[model samples]
Target: MHSSVIATQCTGAVISQRERQTDRDKEIVLQIRGHHIAKLDPLGISSADLDDKDPPELLYSHYAFEEADMDRIFKLPSTTFIGGKEKSLSLREILHRLENAYCRHIGVEFMFINSLEQCNWIRQKLESPGITELTNDEKRLILARLTRATGFEAFLARKWSSEKRFGLEGCEILIPAMKQVIDKSTELGVESIVMGMPHRGRLNVLANVCRKPLEQIFTQFAALESADDGSGDVKYHLGTYIERLNRVTNKNIRLAVVANPSHLEAVDPVVQGKTRAEQFYRGDGEGKKVMSIILHGDAAFAGQGIVYETFHLSDLPDYTTHGTIHIVANNQIGFTTDPRHSRSSPYCTAQPLFTTFTRTRLIHVYTPPSHALTVLSLACYHQSRQPHAISFSESLTLGHPVALIVLDEVCSHM
Candidate 1:
């Protein structure tokens, strides 16, 4: 029915649980909400940099107060009202759900968004704090993708022990999530996708998600031994494109990953420009036929100025690519250095990126891979349902096509 009805019912459900008082978990939930534990225990902390005093919350008494059921609360959002689950849940249950919703493999840092309006828009959109309903087949496919990601990296590590493959060891889910994006895009009638990213998981993305031939990857790795070709970059920096058949629609989908220099974020602008070109070449002036997805390292996405430039570029009349879905790889650590020394913010999702926009709808998604992918799927489906840009009637169209900027600065992304 109405979003207000949904909102009212959701809040009333929470109140009803408090009125009933079924178990200690409900009491723990009340205490947890009072403490605002979700803000206190974010998943962005670098485990490598963690000390004995900073063990993970699940491992220690991370909460301040001591209660009889302190250990009985669920830390994950499995029972939360999110994800389309219809069961009535206790406050503690929803708190656990909130924790996973905000502090899992992805964590949106929109709390720092400058304007109250922008914050409210994001809260209403992606931050509804619930999980999406996923089929068993989709779950199994996601698991298979995860397995493929880890298995491939392990193979490369064993084969080239000393080589810096920049393995997707921790963030294997990235490739799968991206694959989900492409699948979602094609489902939305998007024909071509131009992606750009730094070098951390480029090799994994190249080999696994891009579906580049294994033989080609092996050949490239062998070529990296000698500097004869003078390609100027290593194997991981190399870019490739592959076309896949969208069986249901009987359409051809082209996925292109643009090549980049050693600079962490330089590829962003290039990807946007390239996506715009694809739109023009295809003559889809409404900007619906093409899309862009830029992957970034958490450190670079926050530290670099070019990242900010791309956000501004999208608004310009000549430079706008209609939309782009930004995905920050956010491996947590920048090479060997920890984040505490690199950035001042508590989260890697920087505020300067989109918080300042006056009219644009900013969507921040930072949940774990399973939830992130599901949310992403719903976003694409909604985007597909959004009314197409009508004939030019106003100066500089108010609403651009959908641009989903995914933030996965969570520790579990590892």
Candidate 2:
């Protein structure tokens, strides 16, 4: 054998080995993706048939590989919880971790983030087992918040059964979800949060989340003469400013829900402008001290033109509020149209967030109310870095007549 021939054979052998390793990595990545689809569609009526059957197995490998193979070949971090703590990697463990992260409650849509750093950060936060677990006290707090939200709506219905109050009926979870965002932002050193939302749940948000005075809100329900010089809008179309201490964070915080008119998405720019001004006044160049939270209706989020226009402002040097937390309270029905008819895109919020060059992270939550609140809190933690959007697409019970009208329209269309 010639020396040159030996060298060529050796090089060929090394190349073959590298190719095998690359093929193995690709297979593992595909398997990880399968974990996301393991469960049936929680909200889909079609999935009711599969409810009794065990969730179909997505991992074909059958957990045959050992721990060493996982660390060397999988490459992804381990988030498997065996005994309430993160454990070492294995083929079986990886499947468990991916299931907990992606399949259980929340389905995070951050693979399109474009930045490897951001993607990995989300994986770590969400993929890590026990990351979404809340303490007993925290769970109790959420329950209390939910109770207040439900009770307020119930009272309003009895008080004004025939009146046109755009109450938060089906999407009562939104109140606790918004509170979670505020609480998490406060923990991250945010002193002021400027929020904007449509009329669907403005009064509930005003009463519970903003902690507006009960007397002031009750007075608005009256049909008396205008207290202000100008003609007043509907109660739900109103906004309030409250500066109070966040008892949870023990920090003084300012909460302002910007008033929006019947034009559902017109307040988006106003919220951004308010957030940007606060950042400027406080010299929060990085938007650490001030942030914005914009809430949108599912139909308006996709159908409205201003939602896209406001997103374009996020990356502008002068107009950017560093990052804004967008929460879409998707009841799956528009003012008069169903989501299937109104939204061409899969997610109403996804298109607007990704249409611009801005790096926006979206989390599509399909969890129960309690788990939904916890997942929302995790989503808010990433907002200060860049714009983040969370869509809570859970089915809500619509008790109001207007929501019933929307539902009737949906059923008729069906």
Candidate 3:
């Protein structure tokens, strides 16, 4: 066996191997393509495709796509063809069409019409239009549908209270809190975010935070009777992904809400590990360009030992990921179990546990009507790269339970 053949088989290159040749057999040295193929394997050739004199088992390994390749794929223009002669339209005209289509689709005739009118007046310097093409009956139908889809009053009466057993007030508090995290992540330079929360007001958050199409939600609700295994999770467990342009950074950001199982805080560590790996691959060391935000149920955050295990891993050498922003969706009761029975902690689930770790701050937020605390908490977390816990405590009527916690722990050693 020639040394050149063995080198070529191992390294896919041609190089010299002096040890294989006998001291007396110098004249019989192997030569390939004008180079001394003593030990050196030929460069730029596969092992399997080597000349018949030195063929091997495996061939060329397929090259994988690099980051730049993925970016090119995503930015490729859509193949869907739009028919019509392309003509420039003013921003006002484009906005008018957009407003009309949005309102018409959502059945929010009055609000969209009012907004459109205001926009038209400002841009075109024209007075608001009088009653237009849509008749009173048609307007009523649109308004009724919009109310059914979005209005808090209708949401509470027919959907939230009836379907999920959550009050209108709770939905109001939860929706804004979810949205606040999404909006704040976008405001920062975070390219993508994933949220995990149990089934509470998952439907409301989907509609409001992720901006899922209302028609899709309605269709799911309508088909519940006929479909046994529909492509829908319970309103709270369903997940959504949205991409938006961050106004501050003038760059695009992706937001994802992970579908969580009923195992409660099980998803917390999974989300953290994933986000940290993603950030590292993207060259975001020590939370410079990426973030992981987790939403938790109050009882699960307190009672689940996984929550403590996850918190402990935040500062560990192998799994420390700068830290994740943890939000506790504290709804007071875990199904039927009250807070007293759920845990022995005084403050809520995440706050007391986080206090065990140094340099971790737990902020108790009392704002239910205003989502300012949630938004501010996220802002501070991203800016400081610290693990912070923002707990939202419910009102007296809501039993004064903790509503939400925002945890932002930074990797110290990194």
Candidate 4:
């Protein structure tokens, strides 16, 4: 009689354990499904546009559901799972956190990430909770740069009403972001960065970030001749090479802003060639010390054939400058032409950098001057010192052109 009763008790305990596990498995499945359905664009759409309203088709069936048993709970997430670390919150709460972190104002398009290892590393960094924080000093530095950029432009508008400074009104944040990029790279032991950009916002970047003197800029407007040999095309197109000490990185960075022709994006390859020459002069056998940075307007980046030609050159074994950073100062409208007429791609960052070349990272972020450094650190933190690409949002104006800041770092093999 005693043996029979003991057997009955054991059977009941097994059934009870199975029922509890079944409920937990159902809950975890729902959360995982929610993660994949998260929104990822800054132009936040209404709830009605949500096509992912229904659960994924696979989760409806018997096999896929049963396969996700309680045994898998203690293990890492599988190929279909879309979560990071285990959390204590309810299923809805966890999904909300995941969406906010990965799919906020900064929309990162990493579908073209080439290596499986790199893709995983980048996803982990971007999805982590601590990715958003920055030190206090970093914030102050960004603010100072923003103030200088805006202050200089405001002064110019008042002082020289007739002169077309091509001011950085919408994209004042570019200055501070560049400041942070240089500082961050300097911290990582990069010695120099060669930058190229269009005439738009040229004056502001020159004066505020490049440390060009205001008096010289004013003098050029007063006495400059027609843009002839392109040596220093009219004052706005004039180029400068200088160095600044970065307190945050405790390193000095040498920067050269190359003069660009009015013909948009004509200087893309020119800057690369110059950067390679500089690397050779410095005896950077591996092209690791010097980085080439080029800024582009959104229209030029996508529509121009020259941009593709320039990208192809980087693929050649002889022509790689380790890596180059490409920033598209994307103000939505490229010149007077609307985006509908100019670009065939959906988002500005959705380009062929990874598909054609296979060695780039493309990230998009909405950056006002206030959030410049914080956004920059988050973009750079995951990449570890490797070359990749990133795009920053310009505060758009209806009548004025919108600039998209595209940053691409060319990768070098050791």
Candidate 5:
């Protein structure tokens, strides 16, 4: 009788452990499905057509799970899962984290991508808690970069106050944003990057990103004709080529900024052609060695037909440059007209998606210090096989610290 009782007890223990494991798995599956459904954007639907909704939870009644079990699983700060560490959290903490991950300074829209792997990769980066926290060294680097961008603009205003230059006064962070793209691409084995942009911030990019000498840039402002033949173009319309060592990755890379005409977005196709030629010469069958970056203004990107034409050529085997990183500096105003008067759709980035059905990723950065820029850079180089577009919501009338003050005021009003 004693032996039989002991065997029965062992069998009961095994059954109990299996039940617990099954329950945990069910909860995980339900949470994943619910989160995915919640994030899907219903295109062409107005907010008025939708009813008020509560926190999303699985309505499937077959599984027995508590309200606490349905709470989404996120990587909470100070909670280590290593060595079977238990994650114990209150309901409030879980809700707070949910808000932080999806509603913070960085916003991503990638659900339209047909590939499950691509969607999940973007979801993991954005939904993981505490991923936006920056190290002390990174903070210092951002500050230094911002100083260089602002100082360059400030110096121009002081010295050549009367010159007719299209300055990057309010949107200085774009300088560092471009550098981040170059650094990340170089680290990911891209040896050459050809880029094209409008005249708005060309002088600053030539000085900083292409490493053009300050003396050469300043000479353009001087009241004199060019001494060198074929150097007759204006400062911002000029092109640059530099092969230099990228200090961050310890790699030598080639950079070329294609010369653009007065028609701002005409350089879009030129950049693609140059990048494709380079890839062909280098025998980059899969476009692992050469890439391109194209910068667009909010007005030109939405109004220009060439932008649409270039996006359609992305998938053609002969014309494809593997991928291009498009950065749209949206000031929310097209020239002097507001978006309310200009665009029928809400965002400029959505135009290509609606028309061409291009497989692209869209990320919006509301603040300069957010990780969206890094995420955008990484997505382009890591995927290295598809096109990506990222739009920055910046101010035309206000810049950094002042913009912070404006934010505070707007928040107070809210």
Candidate 6:
């Protein structure tokens, strides 16, 4: 009789334990359902039973809720009931109120809880407004230029091309511009012209403008040693020296582009220094001869503080070079990002900074395949002997001419 009673009690206890577990499971399911419904409704609802001790995994499993769904529940208000009875609310309620306040302040319709904190901070500090309204003309111009240069396509090609490949569109513009500079320098009786630019179309400029032997370039590509001292540089990065007799001016000129490192705009000061030294060596009187021209990327020029530093040195007593002409290849995008994101200012090239020069001028030219304006701009820059900048916006068609000149001196002293 004692054994029978003990067995019966044991069975009853097991049954009661199972029943309690089943009830607990049902309660967890109900809580998750309530959380889901509350999340869907923006009016905000809370449950008092929601405690830190509740097993998140069990509640989520009972309701078949995904991880994301559970996250949403945790973000909801924590009041047990949907009434305004409690003066101070739980963590969820506080968070919901904060979110509502932020959304109202920023005028945003919805808030993403995951990024809410960051968004609020940005809204308050950066004063980030909604999207900008672009004009029809602006849209058309942007599309036209992007299509012409095909900057994206060029970038893709460069990535897969030869190891040290040159950029395409800018190269096309630069080669002719360089040729014009050489031609003009020759015409002006400049015995030597030295140029510097970052790696854009260095290879193209090398092959076409500098007239570097294609065979040497090919050998360099093959990684084969040649009897040339320029094996250290990419075909485009290599410098060249050219001597020519100008048919029009009946003068001889020597031209050389300085080899530069990958540091963009860092070469500006170096070029100026080299030109001044060359002028002094030639024993030329002030502003009579020797000139320096620098080509810059639009995004790099504006985004890099170094460009401003280099520009500030342009008018300095010791660093001046008649004047350094700045040419900006405005691709409207830098690397993979757009201009608006890269620069705070309207223009990517800061031409206005040099306004102190009486002869300083800023010209924006559309690029076309013929590059007539680019050629013309170079001629003007060489003739004027003044500081100038030309910006080539992307709206210009591919193969378009884009160039600017800064002529700070009449002629090279040598």
For TM-score, the strongest prediction is 2
The parts of candidate 3 lying over 4 Å away from their true place are 1-153, 159-162, 165-168, 224-232, 246-251, 350-352, 368-414
| Model 1 TM-score, 2 decimals | 0.63
Candidate 6, residues 1-414, lDDT tens digits: the string is 010000000111323556335434533333222222121111111211122233333332433323442223221122122213443333233223333322221211111212444334323331222222357975664455344334432443544453545455432444545555556666655566666777665555555555556676567657787445654765546666666565445777665677777676777777878888888888864534666667777667777777677666665677666655666655444554445556655345443443333223333333311101111111111111111123333322211112221121123222
Error of 5 at 36 (Å): 16
For model 4, how does the per-residue alpha-carbon lDDT over 1-414 read when each residue is reduced to its tens digit? 010000000111323556446434543343223223333322322221134343542133422323233222222233222344542333333334445544444544444444566555655665566576677877887788888887887787777756766766656777887887777678777898888888777878877777776666677767654232335556667777878876777778888888877777888888988888998999986656787778877766777888777776775777877666677666555554556666556544434443335355555555611101011111111111111122222332232111111122222111
Candidate 5: worst-modelled 10 consecutive residues by lDDT:
1-10
Q: Residue 377 lDDT in model 6?
A: 19
Task: Assess every candidate by TM-score.
Answer: 0.63, 0.74, 0.48, 0.70, 0.71, 0.48
Query: lDDT tens digits, residues 192-270, model 5?
Result: 9999999777888888888876777787889565432247887778878889999889999999999999899999999
Model 3, C-alpha of 149: deviation from truth (Å): 11
Model 4 RMSD vs true structure? 12.9
Q: Tens digits of per-residue lDDT for model 3 on 354-414?
A: 5445224343332211111111111100111111122223332233122222121123223
Steric clash pairs (candidate 2): none
Per-candidate local distance difference test: 0.54, 0.60, 0.42, 0.55, 0.60, 0.44
Alpha carbon deviation, residue 52, candidate 5 (Å): 15
Candidate 1 off by > 4 Å: 1-106, 109-131, 224-232, 247-250, 358-414
